[model samples]
Target: MRSVASRFAPYQELAEHLLQATISEPMDAAHDVGHLLRVWGNAERLMAEEGGDRSVLTAATLLHDCVHVPKDSPLRLSASSMAAEKAGRVLDSLNWTAGDVEKVRHAIEAHSFSAGIVPTTLEAKILQDADRLDAIGHIGIARCFHVSGQMNRPICDLFDPGADRRALDDRAFAMDHFQTKLLTLTGSFQTATGRRLARVRHDKVRDFLNGLLEEVLPDAMTVSH
Candidate 1:
């Protein structure tokens, strides 16, 4: 796989400047600069194979989380829409062509899981899949716990880590996020490469979950001793 830096070589300077100016101060760790870079890297990898308007995808990735909403806020679902509106102004300030700016805005608006808008363009789909990829696997695990901590949620449910017998409430327990969102991302990917990569990452999540379960429920490992 080519280095993500190489993929963003053309847009690196602009992306960095825009990010510095737009990303919220005291950002949520789950959606920090590191998260933006990972999402861009994922977009590059998927775009390399899937093919799309690289400029639009790149801009969308960098600006997707420009508007950060608290995890527990009722407006959480509207973050993407808010980001899209803000991104338009930012792109215009940079003198991006109006047409290109609209494309970027559309991609950003549709990228959110809560937005419920199907990506109508290849660039939009790649942006959506790339962002979602960051929410699974090893990086996803780190982000899950990071957000959980930010929201004052426990790392796991001491009694039902997998939510087998209770309602799935990711807001209350980080582990419930796997079943609530992460595990389901593979099938939600738009591009074939996204799906392939998501499957590999998805397995990593399964491994983590299994390990956690075995540690928490040692009797599940017993053989009638």
Candidate 2:
């Protein structure tokens, strides 16, 4: 708990208390403690510029994935709301005020794209932006492949890698996800800071996809051509 608290300054005590009280077991490589740290780091960066409730954002980030659903699960859409509900119960057990708990709960639920929630609160917006930041950059690239491997999905369709003839299906090929979701995340960011950061990561994804195509394509482009 101290180590976890150390990463979240100014809210070290709150982080420690929540860390001790929360009963979250590790879910997957993509949503592990490292993922939490990355999202919290992003929230801190966003808050530095956007201005939000530090306590609310901190609590939301810590307990956001307390309930985990697999990326391939049919229940993926409900994962965020489920997490939010469970987080509310956890906060209630810890004697948190109902208003603050609701704020945290809303942030957790609205952070998910699958949840289709429009973030109404500043904290919810911040959490959504912060969480999305982790889904696009080099870290996002690593996590994408990691989850792909876990799901037993191929990196891409070698013969028709760009999905020119068919609709994008991320569930079938990992690379299709770039077109279906990852590349589109920049526009969906709720905060200006998140959008700014997302552009840089977004470029990295494009570069990576280009490189991947160069390697896998049958008639790879040549320098002279």
Best prediction by TM-score: 2
Q: Which candidate is the best by lDDT?
A: 2
- As for candidate 1, its clashing pairs are none
> All candidates' lDDT scores?
0.82, 0.86
Compute each candidate's TM-score over C-alphas: 0.90, 0.93
lDDT of 2 by residue, 1-225 (tens): 688788988888888877654445556888877888999999989999999999888899988888878887899999999889988988898799999999999999999999889999999999999998899979888999999999899998877888876788999999888888988888988888888998999888888877777788856432210
* Candidate 2 stretches greater than 4 Å from native: 20-23, 218-225
Residue-wise C-alpha lDDT for candidate 1, range 17-55, written one tens digit per residue? 666645554587788877878888898898889999877
Backbone clash tally for model 2? 0
Task: Return the clash pairs for model 2, or none.
Answer: none
